[model samples]
Target: MGQQAMDTFRSCIPLFQALSDTARQDIILLLAEHDRLTVNEITEFATLSRPAISHHLKILLENRLVEVEQKGLQRYYSLSLDPAVAQLKALIHTVETTCCKESF
Candidate 1:
């Protein structure tokens, strides 16, 4: 692989890792549906404890997959259609078109 492709693959690792957990996926789906929600609001639909929810949120926050809104004493989190998702799709395309192309 060229340096550029390798770099893209390397960067995609963290984004994929962040999304690999079921809890995080659930949180993302919930955020997608609601647009924005507080931690308590997210926890209400979750089977995990508040701390676990916070932990999942932290991972999502670090990945830049979710945005935060602070209102008075509350913090609201919302899903972001991030650049990372586009980058990931591009990387997948690069692989499919090159390494795994259909035989002709």
Candidate 2:
């Protein structure tokens, strides 16, 4: 792979790690369905405890997969997938243009 491809993949590692967990995936889907939700609200639909949900939310937030909004004392979480999706798409394009070309 070229340096650009490698760098793109490296940058995406956190996103991949954030998405590797089933709990995080569930949380993402929940947010997608509901548009936005609080930790306690998400906890109601999930089998995990509030703290556990918050932990996953933290990871998701760190990776930029989700965004948070403050409403008084409550915080609402929602998907902020555009940046991550654009990165993944760039990775795909890099692989197609570089790796696949080299293979052929």
Which candidate should be chosen as best, given lDDT against the real structure?
A: 2
Clashes of 1: 0
The pairs that clash in candidate 1 are none
lDDT tens per residue, model 2, 1-104: 77888998899899999999999999999999998999999999999999999999999999899999999999999999998999899988888888784653
- Give the lDDT of residue 86 in candidate 1: 92
Question: Which whole-number lDDT from 0 to 100 does residue 15 have in model 2?
Answer: 91
lDDT (10s digit) by residue, model 1, range 1-104? 67767787888888899899999999999998997999999999999999999999998998889988899999999998667689788898767766675853
The predictions' CA RMSDs to the true structure, in order, are: 2.0, 1.8
TM-score of 2: 0.94
Q: Using Cα atoms with residue i matched to residue i, what is each candidate's TM-score against the true structure? A: 0.88, 0.94
Compute the lDDT for candidate 1. Answer: 0.88
